[model samples]
Target: MSSNIQIHDIVITEQLSDRSYRNRNADLEKQAFQQLAKQSSYGAQAILNALCDLTLSLCDADSSGVSLLQVVDGEDGFTWNAMAGSMASYVGGRAPRHHSPCGYCLERGAAQLYSYPERFFEWMRLVGKPIVEGMVIPLYGKDKNAIGTIWMISHRDGHQFDRYDLQIISIFANHASAALRMQELY
Candidate 1:
């Protein structure tokens, strides 16, 4: 909403004219899915943690995590339920429901790409690392309602996440949505 928030919708199927990464590695994606499937037996939290690690490695991101919608004292917000990479220490962090990028993505019901979010979110500056690029995908529940978001962030100044990265993340997001629905059932 603010001028500092520079974000745009990323159509998952439309490859950007100016690509960053070449293309998705089918072998790598297969291996990542295998890893996730193997970890599925460990339960939801484990799966979410594994997702974060996989996203960090797969996207070459500075940080990756899952943010679940939550209510604390009747105030809506998001809890960083899982995290990996440079932001691992923020695993239990909480952010406002409406003011953050993930929240906006859920509201729009689409994937979003953001650059230098801290420049607008102000509070993100506390994380100590500037987010050069932040991509967020909304996660959904079995009833087709918004549940949370899984995201990747790059701290490198000029890093550009192309369609290949989005393609991979979209798969991760589907896995995440299923996992969350399973978690809710038990």
Candidate 2:
């Protein structure tokens, strides 16, 4: 008896894409909600402050801040409402509505990280130094439209953001959006 073997061609494909951010911490989520409930009673600004403080700790970034859409002298822009950590120096800084990192995040309706975003902004650095690394999450208001963004920043050279950081900051963004919507009501 004779046996025959057959060989077939094999094809392989390689694709590279950015990593998706997804982190779910039950305890953290519960804690965040509880805090958001309390802060909501005070106002959106208070909630933003809480979120900024939490973002700094959650992402372990050098700094964290919240920017809200604003109109100043017939000009549209973003303004720092809450700031923590190293970037707190610019708590009241303003940036042009367009061509700003916050605008980018809002337009994309996503979370992202970048380095030295202030270089491309016309109104950034109104109070503090240029950012080294930044994480931005868009905030949607009651209308479900992007009103601004909440972000985390790192001034150090070696601190790079990862998927985990993005996911955690996203959680904060969710809560911030709700709070902002509540603020809009009052």
> What lDDT does each candidate get?
0.82, 0.70
The window of 10 residues in a row where model 1 has the poorest summed lDDT is: 6-15
Clashes of each: 0, 0
* Residue lDDT tens for model 2, 32-104: 6778778878987788888987877677778888888999889899988889987677788787767677777
Clashing pairs in 1: none
Alpha carbon lDDT of residue 75, candidate 1? 88
Question: Which parts of model 2 are misplaced by more than 4 Å?
Answer: 1-29, 122-130
The Cα RMSD of model 1 versus the native structure comes to 2.9
- Give a tens-digit lDDT track for model 1, residues 18-131: 676666688988999999888778888888898999998898988999998888889899999999999999999999988888887888888887767776677888999888
Question: What shift in Å separates residue 13 of candidate 1 from its native position after superposition?
Answer: 13
Q: Clashing residue pairs, candidate 2?
A: none
